[model samples]
Target: MLLKSIHHSLDELICLLDQVSDHDYTKSCEALSNATIGEHTRYILEMFKCLENGYDSGILNYDYREGNNQIQTETEFAKQCIVEIKMGLKSENKTLYLEKVINGLGIRIQSSYYRELLYNLENGMHHQALIKIAILQFENMAVNEI
Candidate 1:
């Protein structure tokens, strides 16, 4: 069921991407402090990617995203990333460790695959809201319902 919600969100995101022109998709938005829509989409995808990469290792580290510039500069590449993320979401739930740096110290907390998926869902939604705000900053821009 959670996977269904995540897939639905990705579908909506893909639909939104289809409506965005290449120019608008990579245009830096003042509302986002000069961040592009593709950048936010990349961030959203990378979180899930971190989870997927860590599923086998049993350690998830969000601070270590590869920061692929292509994902931020190419809208089609970002869309392909979303599709790949959906494909990778079918793993069974398992015990996982979320490793993070807090106050200059690394910490690990027990987590599960499903729990991280939920976190990714909420994170994606939050970024989507920011993306909407950025789109509104464009002159004569129309945001389609997603």
Candidate 2:
């Protein structure tokens, strides 16, 4: 059952890619991976870490490792900032840490939703945000109509 589910997921993902144009596919894929969104909806997600010794002794600052085949020119500031945010979770303050995690998730969700909207707008998909909204809002709108 698990393997079947995995296979179905892969097939669905491939079909999604095939349905969109090259540009929309690329944009949506990158937006999925990139927390730092772009275009009019420039939503930058925090990494939950802080860089620079000023923030924390363990926080990495300007230590761009090489030969690991990673993004060569990663933003050190952003990386550190994320680290700092993560450190906050380790603190005794549960409420604060939970809030940070929730906010981060919300930001990620909004970015992807907007990306989907943008891709549909660009690639001439059937529905933009309104279509997606309607589908979500639909109650027993399926063929069964129960």
Candidate 3:
């Protein structure tokens, strides 16, 4: 049931992403480019679910290893997400969209944090990444707002 909430929220997010018209996408991209942290914050929330809830409806983040002791990082992917968002839409008006996305992230994080505490923390791997992601998102939003 708990995982279902994450899945539900993920579904909502996916739907929102899907519903992004060409205009919205362009706006998102523009917003992302000019000191916007909303997209990154969202990607982290979804990616964390993918890591925590495997085989579930949640979209899981996966990385491939090219060679021995070589691991792919999400850095490129993160940058791409921003670029992609920018490509779709011209940047949004700072006074409104930023506030909305940031507010949405706060709600999503609260949902995920509880889900992790309920299902993930018990016999789970290091939760540091999740914490870091959340902190970064929070920090990014806060930093941009200033």
Assess every candidate by TM-score: 0.91, 0.22, 0.28
The per-model lDDT (C-alpha) reads 0.87, 0.25, 0.31
Candidate 1 per-residue lDDT over residues 1-146, each given as its tens digit: 89999999998888878777778889998878999998898899888889889988989999989899887777788889989999988658999999999999989999999999999999999998899988886676556554
lDDT (C-alpha) at residue 32 in model 1: 86
Model 2 regions more than 4 Å off: 28-146
Which is the leading candidate under lDDT?
Answer: 1
Q: Cα deviation of 121 in candidate 1 (Å)?
A: 0.3
Model 3, span 1-146: residue lDDT tens: 54444344333333333333332222222323432223333434433433433323322222211121110123333334434432332221111111113544522122333443334322122222232233343222221110
Clashes of 3: 12
Order the candidates by lDDT, highest first — what do you get? 1, 3, 2
Please identify model 3 stretches exceeding 4 Å from their true place.
Answer: 26-38, 49-146
Tell me which residue pairs clash in candidate 1: none
Worst 10-residue stretch by lDDT in candidate 3?
A: 91-100
Model 2 — TM-score against the truth? Answer: 0.22
